[model samples]
Target chain A: MNASSLPRWIDIGLLPVLNLIAALTVAGVIIAIIGENPFVAMGVMIKGAFVYDGALGYTLFYTTNFIFTGLAVAVAFHAMLFNIGGEGQAMIGGLGVGLVVLFLDSVLPPLLVVILAVPAAAAFGAVWGVIPGWLQARRGSHIVITTIMFNFIASSIMVWLLAGMLMAPGQMSPETRSFADGINLPLVYEVLQMAGFSVSRSPLNLSFVIALLACFGVWYLIWRTKLGYIIRATGHSERATIYAGHDPAKIIMLVMAISGALAGMMSLNEILGVQQRVILNFTSGYGFTGIAVALMGRNHPIGIVLASLLFGALYQGGAELDFEFQTITREMVLMIQGLIILFSGALAYLFMPAVVRIYSSLRKPTGSG
Target chain B: MADLWLQFVLTIDATLRVATPLILCAMAGLFSERSGIIDISLEGKMLMSAFAAASMAALTGSPLLGLAGGILVSVALSLIHGFACVTHKGNQVISGLAINILASGLTVTLGIALFAQGGQTPFLNKSERFTDIVLPFAEQAEHVPVLGTIYKEIISGHNLLVWVALFSVIVTGYVVFRTTFGLRLRAVGEKPEAVDSAGGSVSGLRFQAVIIAGVLCGIAGTYLSTAHGAGFIREMAAGKGYIALAALIFGKWRPVPALLACLMFGFMEALAARLQGVEIPVIGNISTDLILVLPYFLTVILLAGFIGKASPPRSIGVPYIKER
Candidate 1:
């Protein structure tokens, strides 16, 4: 049967099912090659990610990082800008927190101090985006190349600074000092208990709340505001936007800065809410995964959140795949991630064009009605 | 006099050895980009082929067969990108990214399955690996003037792949500038709408160009794992494709100038690799990972001035929408 004969639109819940199915197809092949039973490994991953104590908590914890970066990438996609420099932005954002917390830690009260750190990190991340964004808008530089280069620069600069001026005292830790203990996200477990909400363990924290709020804010900005209108307009047709008297260059620069600030928040969230310190190589390909999330979500904020959770499960589960299945390596899980992104981003356009056409045709008369 | 000559000899040798893979990959980018596709997939193709070449060479005990195997696999990956972007009118950047992520996963999976070690192939024996070709004239030519010294040090005593890269550059320059197919390829990149109306198939031309790129990148990957160095390692292409993309843009997609851009970046990387232990005057000792960023930083600097002005082929990233 043709794709059109199936449901014209998948249920929002079913999207994950399709993604999981597609992912498993790729993973199943890899598992077979590795001489492992795909079913047993899948079962173990489920147990590892959900049934085990703290497994689900860690899953949501990982998702907290994803939401920030995913929102960061999604914001850029709203304006047809690809913030390929998210990794660079995160590093600079982390450094911004370090710089701010290092000198300004004692000057301000703890609560206000944490509040101030967020904007400072945003500003620092914006600086990282500014160069590539400027070049892209003014010089016709491709964001893909420039942003990739920016990541290298940020990582280099971080390594240089950490080894010299930024190294923590007695820090036998190659990382910065733990954030002043006063700066902390209240233990999620305590916060939940204080509210009289009971659970196995608290994985949801202040940053998780912030991540959800950021998604709502981004959604509002993109769909409900004049600036958002301009962004959507430019993404659709730059020439048309210029014809309408909006400056495309300024829009690109502004949109990219906003995107970078969102990503920079990943650093603040992780450092203040969890890690309490900035370290080299602290990011675990979260920025790169954000690209995958944003694309699979079709640049929708809510869609990105769901995609992040799925990946969160994969990452948490994949971490235990080695223990559960002797033959299954972590690399097999990566194959699943790659396949999902491949089908969603590039292959999807080809995959269901006929269905999309049919659905649109069916709606045209009703929309006109 | 002897010291100065010796220094000169070493510099020339270093330049050629470093420039080989860069040249090959840049040539690959030159073909794909010249035909209107912005091939960010070159990175993925190079990476996957490097893994394939190394693994096959170790398994089969034949370097030549390994080289062929690498080319075939890369071509398959490149063709998928070509089909998606050129045929489906899908976003090129997204498709390129998908291929890259796919390569990363597949290579790692293959590596772990075969080697059972962290995403790395086994080290090769000398019999299975490509060794340096010692020219008969290399030792004999040491008696001549500066020319003999240059030959003995730089030109004569290296892997045959280095010679292939040098020859490939000249041949690529010839094919791009002089051939009818190259003219059609350039025409399509410059104005695909016109080419399409003129009875040339845009998709076909783009596919041909991408395959050319894949083949060159395949050779470059094989060289990286099998010839110049030994055995495939994880993510060994390590931003070389992006550097080659920068080189293509810096050279305005011309073959010879593109070769120069590759050499410049390659030279910088080689210097960084060599300077791992030596302390910089003020900075003191730096980690090799930190030094690796130097080429990327240089790319940004070069792009800020020169790349902004370089005119890309007009139809570079756009899909050829017959209706639009």
Candidate 2:
């Protein structure tokens, strides 16, 4: 069965849903192996992610980071680049944010400092990404290997800076001192309280708003811009892109820069919105998680947002599962995440032939063909 | 001078110990990548095997059983990679990445559930682990001069797996360059369509390559848990799989060169361990963290053609779909 002949809804919607189910089923089997009721765990996870007080905020807070990183991966995907350095880019972005806030908080207005810090993150991330991009473009280095190498290098750099120069004086932990009062992004509950409404506090902050805006911006840039067309063209066929008299190498670097910038913006949600300081390993594995989100979302902005929410819910609920069950730990979430990537990204088309056959049969009754 | 020689010999010994896993993994990667399959999941397979090996050794009190378990688990993973890439024509990198992530998470999750030791297996006793094998006459040779010192310090005292690692390299070199199967493997990787035209099964050869990779990685993982260390710790493979991949690229995907690359990296790590908190005369204190980054940095530089070109197989990363 030809995959292209499928309806758009089935292509985008049904396929992903089926893939997700397949992943969950595998995860369910693992849970059962560990002597837990999969259905009970699922119920617990849903309630913990959505039904509990303040859970929604925490889920959204996680979602904000995913959105930025997902968009980062999505942008690179359009250019046929697998930018796995989002983890490193985001870490460097946090460093950029940290430097700006640290230096300017005492001199500049808080708002100005915050505004400047935003671009600082993007610039740092772009620089981290561009080196690999440039290497791949000019030197014929494979971007995948270079990006993976950069992640390790980024990790080393972060450890060096945080433990040495960036470490807060008089403290043992490898983290920068907190930013000055009012320098941090406004938390969602705090904003709501200022507007005369009482709400439970969570880490969800204005970065969530920024993340939504980034989604819109990505949608506009990819669908409504010439650069998007060029990126997609390069991804579809670099030869065709060359035949069109445009430089695919330049497009690759530019797309990587954009991807890096999007990845960098994740620091806004993590550092500025939550931690208010640069910390060791602040990016966690969110950057890698973005790959799963992008693949599952099919590189679409709306799909990314939805995928990000699902992951966010999983993360928040996984934490709850860790707390509620004796055998279950947070690592189960990581396992589930791996299964999702396996199903949605690697074995993505495993069920496609079967789906195509079923759909064709339903559409054309009594047709042997 | 004698003291300095001793230090150097010890460092070389450490290099051998450290390079064992890297050499094994690089050889593993060589088999897979030379067959036009990009295997980034070497780390995951190694980690899972390490866990399996440690658990088996801990349970059965036999290193051989542990090695068997490790190989079994790794071969299973390799088959999955084959199923995805060969059967489903999925993205090879994604499959590798998923396996890696899954192994990482599953190891810890199972560790916690099974042992309740916070994702660590109980340390194996010497009886249950691969203890160092002192070479014959090493005690008598210890008192002799330079050659005897070299024999005792540099050549002796490594576990059986170190020898296995060295032997595996020789085997890999011969099999990859000297055999008909190797010729077919290289042909399939370079041009699967041509192989298909010649009535050879591209998928079958690729599957064989990955399975060979799995066996090598399994031995590497077993060496890690049972020989290099006493038992499995969470993320015990760490980034050795990646470092091995880098070494494979650095060596231009050849067995002997990849072994040399692994040794170089292992030497760097040994030197880093020695250099921790030690200030140099002119360069001042070199951070151990920075030293850890050197292998990756060098690989990137090498890949960028600062040193030499490292070309991969032409049909690498592209699944072979037979024309209807």
CA-lDDT, candidates in order: 0.80, 0.93
lDDT by residue for model 1 over B184-273, one digit each (tens)? 999988998888898889999999998988999888888889987788888888777877777777776888888887777777666676
Residue-level lDDT tens digits of model 2 in B157-265:
9999899999999999899899998988988889999899999999999999999999989999999999889999998998999999999999998999999999999
Tell me how far the alpha carbon of residue B127 in candidate 1 is from the true structure, in angstroms, after superposition: 1.2
Best by TM-score: 2
Reference contacts preserved by each model: 0.55, 0.78
In Å, residue A178's CA in model 1 sits off its true spot by: 3.1
TM-score of chain B of each: 0.92, 0.98
TM match of model 2 to true structure:
0.98
Individual DockQ of the candidates?
0.57, 0.86
- Writing each residue's lDDT as its tens digit, candidate 1 over A1-369 gives 344354635423344356557767777877777787788888888887888887887788778778888888888887788788888898898888888887777788778878878887788888888788888898777777789889878988888788657788886656877777688666677776789977667445677788888899999999999889999999999997899899999999998898888888778666776777788877667787788788777678888888888778888888888786555666666667777766676665554555446656886798841
Candidate 1 CA-lDDT value: 0.80
